[model samples]
Target chain A: MKKTMTRFIPFFIMASFLVTGCNQNIKSTTTAAKPSVSTEAKKDQGPVYKGKVVGKSNKAKQISIEVGKDKDAKTVMVSFDDKTKGLEYAAAGEGAIIAYEMRDGVPFATVIKPKLATLPPGVTVITPTEVKTLIDSNKDFLLVDSRPGNRYSASHLPGAVSIPVCEMQELLQNLPKEKDKLLIFYCGGPT
Target chain B: MSTKSAGQAVKAGYKNIRVMLAGEPAWVKAGYPTYANYGWVCRGNIVLIDLRSAEKDAAARIPRSVSMPFADFADNYDEIPIKAPVVLYSDKDEETTAAMKILHDNGYKKVSLVEGNFLGWKRVGGSLEKGPVVTDVRWKRILAEGEVSVAEFERALADPKVATILDVRTKAEVASGKFPSSQHIPLDELCKDMDQFVCKIRDLQKDEKIYIHCTTGARAEMAYKELKKRDFNAFYLVAEVDCKGNDCSIEE
Candidate 1:
């Protein structure tokens, strides 16, 4: 019994060392393993934008990602404010897949976690200037404000219809029947 | 109850609608008085009009009033007397908006509508005259209740030195056009830089009231209240200013 007890002490010390290592998060990619959205959880998030880094305006806290191969590739300009999570470690060209919503024609990244792999979901990002120009021309386009209904009625860009992100799936019914027209969605900036 | 449509009519270039509940027959039976017969034909710089067909105008209308048919109003809107208070009536009280539009477009700032048409005028023991119908109802109410009336505004415009009309629409909206002599200021940018507004409105002229207006009156009202807070003698035109090409006017 004494020999058995003596041997168990060494095993106990080894197990504790492993546990301490895990608590410290000692790994190859050592920044931090933040809470990631699983496949089912991500279903409720806003649209995902996967693309290659085309431009980065660090001062403006903006990034332009190109999401198609060659000529088909479309560039999307994404903006982030102080409240944006996962932005600190998000470097350009790290194969980004951004989950975002637009507000007043500006693309705000709500969840910006890039996959470590190649091509993902790359959508066109409409700029506020472009939207304004379109509005001035009185062109046909769906300007969707993806915020809560109360927030929308309180104050939103003129002509923007309310459609919150949580119920984005239901938007399929409200979308214009004419597929040819432009459909754009926007949300609160980096809240 | 139906004022919403009146406001919308103003937006659509048909301004100043006054609704009458019953016709001239009802008024006469009730022994109500009228403008023509009761020595109430008001004398002032005012354009009284009958918004009826030419045939109807020929049959009966108020004395000293013009016949500008309601349906044809938009086409001949430019001919209204700019400096006069436009008064209007037709077979029904529903046509007041049409008369108001023509008056507004022709730069006649003041507008009033006849609650009783020609029939109502005659029924109210008014003269069964062959002309249009009008009323001093708006003026009386305006003075007493502090309501904004276009007729009052027209009279005010006669003395341009009295008020500085400020156009507070955005550049995009202003690009459509604005009050000819009004100072332009985009309302959204009001607080962004007020020094210029402060500078422009600083000096005093005799009764130099500031009147602000937008395409619609919402922003202008906001700006007016803000300006009023700063102690600048100011008011807002709670009227819809409509424009088609070069033809434009404030529908009240």
Candidate 2:
């Protein structure tokens, strides 16, 4: 029964999301269980993100990817579990594309593939270098650090303040009313 | 409105914006005001623009109102006067919010939606003037406002010390061709990259007039505004400019 519940946990959470609409405080919890039994396991992997694998930690279940090419790159983090694949030969400084899903505001990899990822569209993905340039110039723009509260307060990019994407909906009033304000959102890469 | 609307506005590059507390329906119920007749439209104080299909505009429109379809208005919104009150309307009052927001975002000082829109105008006994629409109403304003004249540019070319020609298009776009002795700083990277932009600022020669231009005039015009906002002596190039290889010409 525990194993059955473990297998259905992500599905149940997703169903709850559909019913409740944008739930905050989603627990980033997962249980180890038997892997998928189906032949379409490859297709079950999630959305793709491509970049250089800057770091890896099997113990913490995290991998960092440097999206964008050359010197203008932004690093992102992705969490993995017993199910994540394609990491056996992944080395630091190698290009990779990761398929992922967000649970409890934390992104987790379903499949790790080898390729340069052009992020799926929502917001324009600008590099950290671009952000550094803006900061260095003293040009005014809102740099939002969309990470957990603890992570943000502990350490964040210069000139960035915490406004986690999970709670961004309710925090509209806190945002700038000025029309010219260029808003930039970033979190731990991929994760 | 969703918080994501803020992200969308930022993506769209708006300078002034406002979110209406109550929608049109509520505003209508309060019955503050919609619009008066076309006589109110033609006071020479307010500019009336029709946001409708060309076919719809060709069928009928208020006298002296310009037919600047929403698509065109969105593309060349910088052409619209930021200081003057712009009254806009579309079929059956649709697109009033969108038009108002676009103008609002572009820093238009005064923006009003035709209360009832096109149908409302007719129902309220406003006359519909048929025939070809006048689209050049804003053209005069676009050139006269802050743009550099061809004569001014010609004089500048004669003396580089008098004015600095800055091209804000992409490196790839300029690799093919550009104006003689013009400084190149790609506009997209200006805010974020600023490798070239910084060089100019640090090497600021405040006395020299800066003439900024892009392929057509939009991005150049925008860059000029940014410089002027920072109190730089910058002028926006409004003329059509074509360049091939190392050769370039500004149209008369």
Candidate 3:
């Protein structure tokens, strides 16, 4: 019965997350578990925890990665220190791969790797200077500023039109009628 | 934002679309003119300078303006902080144009001009003050939160072991030039193969410090988030970088 309850611990934690939202403290009940899992089990040892981070604390040097999927998911609170690798990149709401070891029944993160967002395919990135060059050379392209209206009014690139991303559908008429014309858009640089 | 906007444009039947990821901040940082609306000139946080003669300034000047005569502008331009968002106005078009060039040449990142100058301000019934002005140009640059100081970045550049400089630019951009000691990892590749990247750099532990940079720091910032998410000590430089071979010049 103790082992069966241990298996269901994750489901309870995930249900709590759904109710409490993202901003809440989550604890792992695995604190009392003995250190029977070997650290060298990098392969099918099933020791590596791959999941999305649910919460973290910079001061406490700890992160909670949600392992398993949906109904079976549970938040695993992992503590780290100066010895922990890749601790700088751990953030909540992002996917991460963590390797850990249970010491004194506590899961201590030894390595934390992040899963980053990939840009959508079929898009090419340009620079400010390159856009300027196109403007100076009088290229046959429409330069669009995708920032909010207030920022555009404060200041914007030369010959660029104001087309806020939120209002793109409403301001579709502002774009050139030609479908094949070059359309270059920019906003306040990538955050 | 541009990427999302481009996606919308694509859906709207705009076939050829490209994204300038660096956007307006990068354009202003590259020493280009950004035209300020009349409302911005009246209420925005900016160093509004009357570039006309002292006689013109004392007779009728915009509020929150200092008299910096075009004739002696070269001498007084240095008084304005390089990072100050400067907006200039003068009766003569020639003077305003000349004053903008002077500031841009001197590394003033955010330089702009009031639409239509002083006459335009008055034409729109904008507020003005007369007689001897008391407000002198006063500005000091404060680095944005989390931005790496140029001096500290340079110090790290001089010593490779202290921090690994990660260039997050594309292959074409890197082909032109890069820092001698930077680890080459385009931001797109870093996003897809972060696990492989961590394994590849096994010599440097997860706590190893990495400084990320791109042509205009946009991609560097994006890459910074990725590295930080994985628990790597990372900092991104928010400056315009121009490189020719091994030689590179950074402007903030």
Candidate 4:
């Protein structure tokens, strides 16, 4: 009975980890009531902005976000303070969902959290075990390491071809010409 | 990078694209074999091991390779550093794979096999040695380019006049605490607002020394690159740092 319980311990811990991870993702991606709008969040409040952070001025205590859902999105500058949550995530190239209040026509961020970028449709995530099984079974698939060339040269998956993302444009020829062939890509891991 | 690449692949009209989310590290942790190209075997900073027999190794072996016969690898593998990037090859692919498994199973993080093995090396005209085999592994991790030694950073911290300490961590990170007499500019902010930051530091001479640091040195390196573009004599700390209300410690 003790041995059996010990074997189950790892599963229980993994289950808890998965639960926490899912909850965290849900909270960050869905906290804002409104999506892609600078409308007033509540009574006497300014507005909530959801978009990718474009530029920042730490000295000015302001971050610029390309707000809205369209390509012609306007950049809005939002100020933050010590009280602001997720200030670390307020950087260029990172997605942010900011809840702010306007004071004298200036937006002051009350809460700032990272907006997780969901994976696009058609591209699916494969586990390492699944990939290993494919290799073991002699599957006809192209496993490409999409990290830097140096990293690829240092070490990479067995039978994996090197087509670094940085050099993807120039090295497109290295990729299989047949469009229908399965192409599995991997990097340093989910960052 | 994989996701971005996969997206690009989709755009390029490739169908059935799948991303290995866990990637090489996870694959390695699962005791799977990895392969390195011949160029890496020749030039990479790795402990290349010839896993063939002592007789075969003495007869002919890859240059700069140490002989660790697969028969004796189980007992003597620990002699190689745990952190060393290990590359192995032998006449028999099975022996090479088995040796790699032993290293991975025993907590070696970076282990790979030479692509195509011994005959492959010969075909590529790889340098070779004969007569005797090197038994001992001689390796030491080197600091990356533009990196400051921890001791030097500590000295600069003690004496602010030695070098201007630049803290490139984010505002949230700084809210906890930071070192004394250090200039603050988050990496992203510095990169985005280069003109503004340059104007602020306009008074300093171009040759003035600066030591930059972040939580884990990744951001510091980025900041260092930006500073270098502006021709500032800058070096980044490549080590972990912990701070509490102006008191801090660094580790490599």
Query: lDDT of all the models against the reference?
Result: 0.49, 0.56, 0.69, 0.74
- Candidate 2 lDDT score at position B73: 70
| DockQ score of the complex predicted as candidate 1 | 0.01
lDDT of 4 by residue, B72-100 (tens): 98999998988789999998999998898
Which is better, 1 or 2, measured by DockQ? 2
Ranking by DockQ: 4, 3, 2, 1
- Identify the superior model by DockQ, candidate 2 or candidate 3: 3
Per-residue lDDT of candidate 3, residues A1-191 (tens digit): 36643653453333212211111122223434212222223443336687767556443345666778668866566777789887654665545668888877667788765432112334444556677899899999988877787777777777778888778665588888999999997776311
Candidate 2, superposed: residue stretches over 4 Å from native: A1-191, B1-40, B43-155, B158-162, B170-172, B185-204, B217-230, B238-240, B249-252
Candidate 4, residues A89-180, lDDT tens digits: the string is 67665556788987766678887765532333465556678799999999999998877888889899878888877776765777789999
Task: Give Cα distance to truth, residue B129, candidate 1, Å.
Answer: 27
**Residues A1-191 of candidate 2: C-alpha lDDT, one tens digit per residue:** 46554644453332211211111222112212222221233465556666566556453456666666557655566778888777742445444667889876667787765432211122232334445577679988876655455444433455555666556454465568775567665443221
Residue range with the least summed lDDT across 10 consecutive positions in model 2 chain A:
A19-28
Query: i-RMS values of the candidates, in order?
Result: 28.9, 22.0, 13.2, 7.9
**Candidate 4, position B101, lDDT:** 88
Candidate 4 to truth, TM: 0.60
Give candidate 3 misplaced runs (Cα > 4 Å): A1-122, B71-84, B91-109, B116-131, B134-252
Model 3 lDDT per residue over B69-168, tens place = 8999989898887767888989998888789889888877667888767887889898888999644886545555445677778888999877888887
Give the Å shift of residue A125 in candidate 3. Answer: 2.6
For model 1, how does the per-residue alpha-carbon lDDT over A46-137 read when each residue is reduced to its tens digit? 68676554444343456556566667766566777777766643454334567778866677777765332100111122334445577679
Per-residue CA lDDT of model 2 for B3-57, tens digit only, reads 2343434445544322111212222222222333344564535677888877788
In candidate 3, how many Å is residue A45 off? 16
Q: Chain A only: TM-score of every candidate? A: 0.38, 0.41, 0.43, 0.48
